[model samples]
Target: MEKNKISVTSDNIFPIIKKFLYSDQEVFLRELVSNATDAVLKLKTIVELGNFDDFIDDFKIKIIIDKKNKSIHIIDNGIGMTKEEIKKYINQIAFSGAEEFIKKYKTSNIIGHFGLGFYSSFIVSNQVQIFTKSYKKNASSIFWSCDGSTNFIIKEIEKKNRGTKIVLFLNEESKEFLEYNRILKLLQKYCKFMPITISLSSIEDKEKETIINNINPAWKINPLQLSDKNYLNFYHELYSHQLDDPLFWIHLNIDHPFNLTGILFFPKIEKRIDIQKERIHLYQNQVYITDNLEGIVADFLSLLRGVIDSPDIPLNVSRSHLQSDPSVKNISKYITRKVADKLDSMFRNHRKDFQNKWENIKIIVEYGMISTENFFVKAIKFFIFSTVNNVYFTLDEFKEKIKETQKNKEGKIVFLYSSDKEKQYSYIKEAKDRNYEILILNSPISVHLIQKLEFSYKEICFVRVDSDHIDKLINHKKEDKCYSELSETEKKNLKNIISSNLMENYKFSIKLENLSKKDYPFLIIVPEFLRRIKEMNSIGKEFFEKDKEKYYQLIVNTNHIFMKKILKETCEKKREKMIQEVLNLTLLSQNLLHGKNLTLFISEKLENLTKK
Candidate 1:
């Protein structure tokens, strides 16, 4: 046996590693397991190269927890280290054996880029030991031990098996790592899709051995070999608790510019827009990295759930966060383009099926279109608009369909939409009466999406069905002539009567329009710009509390008999009562009549009916 100080420039290297090297101490297992995986892959590469003649039966990594001894053992049947290699790799800090091996064998399968992975064990363990035997002719086995310090002991030892066994003696602060459930969860989280088979067992329950990792995950396989069922099964495996299966998926297998392979699933998102981040699990060479891929994935695509593996994605030293790099931007753009292409293909090939799935996927699609300009440019070919009648049309199709009739005086095509199908049913009906298509833009982010669309297509404008009177919704430069012979003075008096009888708490501007008699005597119309701003503010909660009062325009139809009756009434009291009833009806239509006002309106209607 020989003892020597670790070859490092500083005596505080171990302290730096334990306290600041890794953000999460639980990642120690990931680092150690990744190192083991690299060893196995290196050995396999050597065998494939015909350098190693010995026939290897199996390649696996086993994690054994010995709670009685307060230690954990990670045993692997892979390329192990000899005494001289141990002295060079284990004693020297930050000198990577995996890097050197990769350069020598020209293999990209090695997972460890930094030699510091072995030292991560000290984050949870006070002392770590390794018993390794190299697969070489006339090779002597080696034993190495380090007690979280600069000093280490390495020597030649007798061993029959040609592999590596690492032992970690847990510290008191890391007692939680000793729990079988805790270690199992960490393994499942970090090593579930590793390239090699990884099994976990407790010495106390050796009979209950559990293989914790899949040797070959679906992402690593060729896309042609996977069926829809295979993809969905893999999706459920990734998110076992999710109730609904994915609507569709895009198999990314790019090797040209950068190595990237993974499956992205278009999950069934509802109308609520639950933008769940960290759903896109990022991986580096099949080793699990962080899931919060802020820089690696486009912000809108973060709403999607799946696995994205790429060795090209730059990561921090600890692999807990993404590092800023041009490669990350390229990867994000590539992913966006792939997703857009997939949707475009689906829309072109399966029109009816895509239409059927629109409601389930529109939120994500719309969000992507609104947030990513490149994605928006590609998505416009497939992004659809669905009418209240459940009819779907692409933006270009809808534009062509409405170009003849729905264009305003400025040549902007008007798009009529409703946020609430039930509450705005009357407005939708009025628009449909004039042969206007009323789209259902009820998603939580529809207001923002509409703004994006308007900015993108300057020749188009979106107006809610209830945003204005039916005729004014689309400016045709034509007006209905009033049938009433009431003079201007009489119109002013009618407005005054209604204004005096209106609820003091309500905020509105009175306007008399020469609308057809078929229109409501008193119609409440919210201006499109104000309503959209309010909706956007509601979504972002960026408005002042005092400025949240509902404001609208009260349009009185001059052709209606109610207006004439109110003006011609000989009794002032009866005229005021009629005006109040009309105001109540308009308020009820707008859903603003509530509490005492709604109760009073109901009581007065019941009393009038009883009198009749």
Candidate 2:
């Protein structure tokens, strides 16, 4: 037996590694298993290159848990280290054996680049032992052990297998690693799509081993060899808890500028505000790295779900998160372009099918258009607008269809939209009466998207259906001729009476208009600008929320019979009652009448009906 100190700059290396090496203590399993995978792949590559005649039929990794001993073993049948190789690779700190092997063989299959992954074992273990036998002929098996310090023991051991076994003796705080369910969950999370087969076995059930990884994941396979069913199956495998199948997916495979391969699925989003990010899992050579791909993926594209495996994606030393690199930006741009191309293809080739899935996928597409300029340029060809009547049209197509009639006096195209078809039913019906198409902009981010669209298409403006009356919404110059017949004094008196009865929390600007007799006597309209700012405040922008004053335009139709009767009535009490009833009706239509005001309105109506 030979004893030596680990060659490092500082004797405190072990404590630093144990305490601050990895973000999560559970990452020790990922690091150790990834090293095992690298070893197996190196041997496989060597065998495939005709460097070795001894071929192992079963190249598998087994994770053994011994609860009684509070130890876990990660064993792999791969290229193991002899005594000298162990000294060179294990004793030296930050000297990557995987890097050396890849340079020697010109192979890209090795996963480990940072030599420090092995030291992560110290994060959870008080002691670690390595029993390895080299595949070289006449090579002696080596035994190496370290006890959370610089001192290590190395000697020749009698072993029959040509592989490596890493045994970690758990520390007091890390006893949870010995539990069967705990280790199984870590394996499922980190090594679920490893290229080599991995199995888990506990001492309680040593006879039975459960396979924990998929040797051939969909992203690692050739795109041409996969069918739609295969893709769907893989999606279900990735997200087993999701009940609804994805509307569609983009198969991304590129090798030109940087290596990137993955499948991104567009899920059916029922609520845009509840959109779950971090669903896109990032991997480095099939080893799961992270799902929080903030810097590596565009913010809008995080709405997509799937796997992204790219050896070129630069990770920090711990491999826990991505580092800032130009390649990351390139990968993000490539993915955005790929998604845009896929959506364009779907829209062109399968119009009916794309239309069928548009409602479920519009949020993603709209968000992309709003956030990315290049994606917006490409998405405009496929990004569609759907009306309340279920008609779909591209932006250009819709512009052409409504160009003749929907233009305001300033010649800018007016796109009418209703956020709630039921709550704003009257406004939607009024627009439909004049042959104007009303779009359903009901998503939580619709306000933001509307601003983005207006900025993009400079000649167009989006107005909510309930934002104003149809005359003001479309802004036909001819409609301005209609005005109230009452004198200015009578109008002023009417405004004061109506304003005094309104809630103090809101401010109403009373306007008298000679609208159609068929229209309601009173119409409450929220100014478009104020309503948009308030809506934006509701969706997380608090800058505008400080105003606290709600504003509305109360348009009283002079041609309506109730208004004329109220103006001519001799009884002051009856006239006041009529005005109150009309104001209450308007407030109820806006869904703003509540508490005492709502109760009073209901009771007054009931009392009048009883008298009749």
Candidate 3:
């Protein structure tokens, strides 16, 4: 037996490991189980290469909890290290710095890049012991024991099995690990479907038995051998509580460039922002590393629910390594492309089903497109827009159909919209009369999104239903004459009467137009540009929020009997009060008449009529 002291820069090393090495104490189970899985995989490879002749193939991991002794043992049948090998790999910390370690072992098949994984045991265990005999011929068994401190002891021991057994003396504060059910749950979370079988102590009827895991997960098996039913069975096993099945799935199996195998599922995305971390699980050699994979995968891919197992990921600096690695970027892009391709294929093969799922999937696709430009370019081809009238069309299809009809006088395509059908019913009716199609962009993000599209596409415009007069929406040159023209004095008097009767908060300007008698005597035209600007201000656009320059036009039919009567009444010195009454009526019709001015107008008209 050989002994060597652990090389540390300071006596503070153990303190650092105890207090600051890992974020959560529960993560200790993950690290220990992950190390065990790696060991089992290595031994399997060795056996496959004929390095271990006549070796027992019953290589199953086992977790046993002894509540009475306040201990738990995680045992694995793997390539157990010899005493000398343990001296090098276990006793001495190999890598002092992350960058140096990554560089040194860039080509190595080593699973744990950082030596701190073993130290994670100290989180839950006051004392730990390892008993093992290497698979090498005539190799002597060894027992290594350590307290939470740096001090440790190693000696030769007699053991029959060629594997390792890690016995953790659970700390008083962490006796939860010694519970039969608790350790079983932890094992399920960290090593449920590892390459080698994992077993937890269980009871069959009245007799004690071992509950073994399903070693060959769906991703590890041959896809050709699995039927559609097989893949669906695995999906149900993964998400038992989810009521609805996934829209589609991508079986990710890549060996070259980087060994990564997993299934990415496209669950029904009802809400765009509901896409969050923890959906993607990161694993190293079938040992779960983390589910909070912000830096590892692109933000948009967080909407994808699945597992990703690859030993190539750097464990020393998980976040920084993921952010800087070119291979990770490539892999992320590939996954995104695969997801997009699957969606497009689904749409092509099954139109009815695709349409049903489109509403639920639109949010995710739109979010991805808006965030990543590469995804945007790809997703736009498959994106379908549904109209307020329950008609669905792609962006290209809609543009082709409406390019001529919706084109404004300025030669820009006007995409008319309405936020509230009831509030803007009058405007919508007038637009429909002029044969204009209206879209319902009621989503909170629609305002900003439409603006983005306007900038992205040339000669495209969007306007709210109540934004402008019906005739001005899609202006066409017409040669017909309008309502009877009014003199300058008549127009001025009409403007003054209405303006004086309206509220201070509301501005009204009168415009004379020749129209048929059936037309409204007064049409309230909320100016297009100012209305949009005000809407933007209300939604917290700092630039236009406080700008006081607002324009609204009170367009009155000059030939209408009510307007003619008001003008004649205004010309009379004693009848000016009656004209004010008529002007108040017009303001009330526009929902603008209120407060002191309206009350005074009513009083003055009553007093004039009484005197007459």
Candidate 4:
């Protein structure tokens, strides 16, 4: 046995590595397994160059848990080092700094760009032993051991096998990793897509060995070779817990500028459904890196779930945290462009299917369009405008269909929409009767998106269906002489009587219209400006929330027979009661009446019926 101090610039490197270089104890296993993969890949390269004559078969990495002895072993059938090679590679630590090594092989697919990866063993173990045999001729087997300090032992051993075996005597703090389920989860997370076959014994079948990883995933293969079914199967395989299938997926591959490969799936997320916020798993050469890829993935893309493998996104020595660099921004922009292209293709080729899925997926797409300027610029053309009638249209199609009728005399194309169809049924019906199409924009971000459209879409404006009278919404046609107009004094008296009964918090204004007698006697209208401000307040806009109190327009139709009866009644009490009942019913239709008010209205309706 030959023992010596490790050749390093600092003697305290081991303590620093355990304390600073690595923080997550679970990464020790990842580092060991990745090193084994690197060793096999190195030998494979020699064979490809025709320098090595041996026919290599059965490449695999195995993880063994010896619970009784408090040790975990990572065994690999890969190229191993002899005595002299061990001294040069292991003893001379930090010879090639992790930063220098990674910069040299930044473009390569090799996982261990950092020489310090092997030292991560100190994170969870107090002592580690390595038994290895080199494949070279005249190479004797060797044993190397270190006790989480500067002192280490290297000795010649009589070994028959040609590979490396690492045994970690776990520290008391890291004994939790000995749990079968915990180790199994780490293996699934980090090594599920690694190139090498990982062998492990399962909890259910303790006697049998199982392959935990899929060596070849669909993202690495050509998109043309994969069918929709193939992609779907992969999706469910990656996310076994998810019950709903993805609406579609985009296979992203790029070699130039920067290396990036991924598959992003858009699940069926509707406005009514709570945003599950599927995280995008970011990887480096099939090794799991992180899912919190905020800087690398646009905020809006967090709704999409998938795997992104890119050697360009650099990580620190521990491979724990991602580095925020220019490459990250470049990759993010590329992904955004790729998603835009995919959506554009679907809209142009499979328009009907795109429309069918629009209502389910539009919230995310709209979010992307609103948050990302580049996405908006590229995807605006393919956006589908959905109507209350369940019909869909592209931005241009809807614009053309309504350009002649929906545009005001000021040349602003109006997009009339409703938040709740049930609550605003009377308003929507009135708009639809005049042959005007009402778009349904009811998502949480609808108000903000409408504000964004006002700026993005030149000479275009969006108004809620209940914002104003139908005649004012589309002023293209002349109003019909449906009923005689009421004088100013009569309108003033009508406003005063309504205000006396309604609560002060609800400020009501009176508007006179010559609508048909069959139309609603009174329609409650919330101005688009105030309603939009209220919407913003509900979603973290505290400045707008302070004044989000609601005020409404109570439009009285002069042509309605009941309005004439109330106006002509001689008994003040009877007239006031009739007016109050009509106002209460209007409020009820708008969902504005609550508890006591709603109960009183119901009681009044029953009493009037009994009197009749």
Candidate 5:
């Protein structure tokens, strides 16, 4: 037994550790539990090598809460500390800088990135007492005690245990640690994946010991050893409160450039962007690290659910350094690459299944492609475009299929899409009648992605099927025919009357086109470029705000009998009512009629029906 002062860089070390070294006071439990797990794992390795003679039959870490005494003890049956080992490892603060330590020992399997985790216990406790018995043959048991200062005492003690027990005397400010439920929650959050059996016991109920963690998680074992049922069961175990199951999972086993192992699950996401959250749990040798793995996993891919255990990820460092680290960037890139590869494989191998799951997985894929250029490049061949009829096609395949029919006059393929199937159903039908394929691009992000896709492809353009005249939607015509001037003049007057009946919020381009008499007389066409710019501005994207106003074309069919009858009506009041009704119907079909305008339209129609 010896009495001495702890070797540290400064006398103010205790204050720094208590206030600043760790942001969360609760992390002290994590640090202590992690150290216990490491000690157990180290003993296991030594036993495998036949170095330790006094072999323990069982190994586990136990947490005992004594509410009356205001003390919490973390007990572990592992390799205990000798006097010399304690003085060397515990007395001295690991102050030799991160770079020096990392250069000396590149392995992270030995404790945390910083070997100062033991001292973290000092952050929450007024005093800490350690009772230890070395596994070495004929070794004496020892007691080490320290208050929240540089002073510590080591002495020989009588003990029946073959391990170490750390008893923390909770400080006045940190008395919450003495609560059984508080300790239980922390254990479940950060220590749940530890590679040792962890249990909790209370002096109140001595017989029942509750085991809290699965020491051997499915991610830590050889993935080949697991079946699909096993994987799903583990997911349910990890996320029991979440009702929906994961769509699919990728068992990542990489040993080449860096050692990494984990399972990444594509979760069943709500068809909304706001509900996406980072559920990717990170671990180091089965010890929980951080859930906010922003730089380690791509921001968009962080929405996936599962576990990632990497001994090579330098997650124990400072936040700024972690964000800028080259290994972290590589890790981020590697994860996206692997995810892209997996998605590509699934898309190619089981297209039917992929399509079935596409609506659920589309958010991640589109978000990833928009957020990362590397993923977009790799995912080009795999980005599928599905039509309203449930038919799916890759970018190139869709283009080739439509090249002969949908090519424009300038030798460019014009891809027609609809934002709303029901509102744009008539336009879709018109395009379908002309043998033109229309894609369903209604996802909120699709507008941004389509704009980006157009930027990538100079020879292609995407126009909403309702954005232009049906004859011009495909640009199949190579010639133009002259029309009668008197008919054109009458169509101009009809356009003027229609425009006068509506609000001035919209910029209307009224034109007459040759069409079947059965076709509707009035059609609304929203231009693609203006509509996209306006949509971008709505989301605070950099675009012309003033140009964000709504604009559409009111196409009148002079060849249709209904249009000719409206133009040829003699009674001015009935003629004006007919024009207003026709224009309101067009606006309703475009989903642009709302509020007071819709109410007034409904009222006018009711009044006319009553009079008739």
Candidate 6:
């Protein structure tokens, strides 16, 4: 028999396997069992190639826990290694035996790529023994043993079948692996969808029976083969306690460019805004790698729950590849394109269903559009905007429907929006009075999206509800005459009275218009562009902050009855107390009165009402 030494000189290999091979200790079970499953698949490939003439039965992988023996065994009817192969593979730890084997049998469609997957046994086992018999005629069976140290033992052994069995002597810290229920739970998590059958030992009526894993998961099969009902049934299998059914599903399968297969489900989200990011699972050859897929998948796709298996995703030494790479970028772009195409197709074929899912799924689409420019251009056609009256319209459709009424002074299309309906109810009603539509821009991303839209589309602008009066929303070119009943002296006195009573941080400006007495007692008008910029800055928008001065215009109407009466009284008696009271009342109505002035105004009003 040939002999070989492990490649690395470091006696710290066991510690490396236990601590550095994977991020989570539980993943060791997945790595080891996945290795076994891959071995069975290679044996099946050899059988199909007709090189190994032995009669290979239906292959299966099995896990056996011996609680009394303090050991766990994983058995597989796969390609058993000969003595020479064992010396080259099992003896040489850190040497990628699987990579060399696949290179030798390059045309066999082998799945295992790295040999170190087996050394993961050291993560939970103090001692590991491997017994194997090759399919070659007259081949001798061999037993290999290692005790988590540099030393090992190998010799001939007795075995009936052409396969391999791994016996792991559980360490004191890893006694949990010997529990039947724990091993079963792990098998379900990591091996449920493996191509080969997997069995776990279970006792019924004190009789031990091997329970097999379900090999053909729904994702591996053709989606066309399964009816919609069958797909829904599989979704229930994945998440039963989840109350609502999925709004939609994406069956991802591709073989030519790179091996990838998955079934991603968009479950009915309760609050689309609070989308969780830990749902998508990344897998390599059916072995789950990690659920934190933020780097591998686009942020928007985090709303989806499912598995993404691909052999092409190159992992670092630790198996947890959080950093960005070319393959990950390609996958993310592909997913974003697929999602956009799926939504676009649904829009064309099934309008009603798309609408039904819009409220929940829109978050995904919106986030993607905002993040990816290409996705934005594609989805802008299907994105729906809702008005205050709960009417939905596509961007193009809405622009078309309101072109007659929403265009402004510069002939630009002005979209009026409000964040708080109750606070801006009067402004919204006034806009509606002039046959203008108000958009509900309640989302935190609205300002950013509006900015992007303004840059993307020419002659389009967004104005807040309280930005300006209704007459100024869509400009009328018919110039009106301006007449002030107050002389220049009266106007000067009125301005002084208004400025003296205004809040310290605020500036009060007076503008006279010949508006009818049917108008408000006093109207405050903030310029459209300035108000939007200020609103944007309040939300931490840097572009608005950079050019901050253009963010507001507080216009008070002097033509109103209250302002007229105040001006007349100020001229008649110069009664400073009455003028201050009236000016403070006007400031309070505009939500501007504050601090000492506000406190004094409230106290004086209370005293006057009490005396009356």
What TM-score against the true fold does each predicted structure earn? 0.95, 0.94, 0.80, 0.91, 0.91, 0.83
Q: Report, for all candidates in order, the number of backbone clashes.
A: 0, 0, 3, 0, 0, 1
**Candidate 6 C-alpha lDDT tens digits along 207-287:** 565454556767878888988887787777666566677888888887756667888888766335564643777777766
Residue 111's lDDT in candidate 1: 86
Error of 5 at 331 (Å): 1.5
Misplaced by over 4 Å in model 3 are 1-12, 95-111, 202-214, 222-232, 275-278, 317-323, 419-425, 480-488, 504-612
How far off is residue 87 in model 3, in Å? 0.9
Q: What pairs collide in candidate 6? A: 530-551
lDDT value for candidate 4? 0.81
Taking all chains together, the TM-score of candidate 6 against the true structure is: 0.83
lDDT (10s digit) by residue, model 3, range 358-423: 766766777677677778787777777666676777777878878888878789988888876766
Question: In candidate 1, residue 116 scores what lDDT?
Answer: 87
Q: What C-alpha root-mean-square deviation, in Å, does candidate 6 show against the real structure?
A: 5.3
Whole-model lDDT for model 6 versus the true structure? 0.73
Per-model lDDT: 0.86, 0.86, 0.70, 0.81, 0.78, 0.73
Better of 3 and 6 by TM-score: 6
User: Which residue segments of model 5 deviate by more than 4 Å?
Assistant: 1-8, 95-108, 275-278, 317-323, 478-492, 503-518, 540-550, 558-571, 607-612
Q: Determine which window of 10 residues in candidate 4 has minimal summed lDDT.
A: 96-105
For candidate 3, what is the TM-score?
0.80
For residue 294, give model 1's deviation from the true position in Å: 0.9
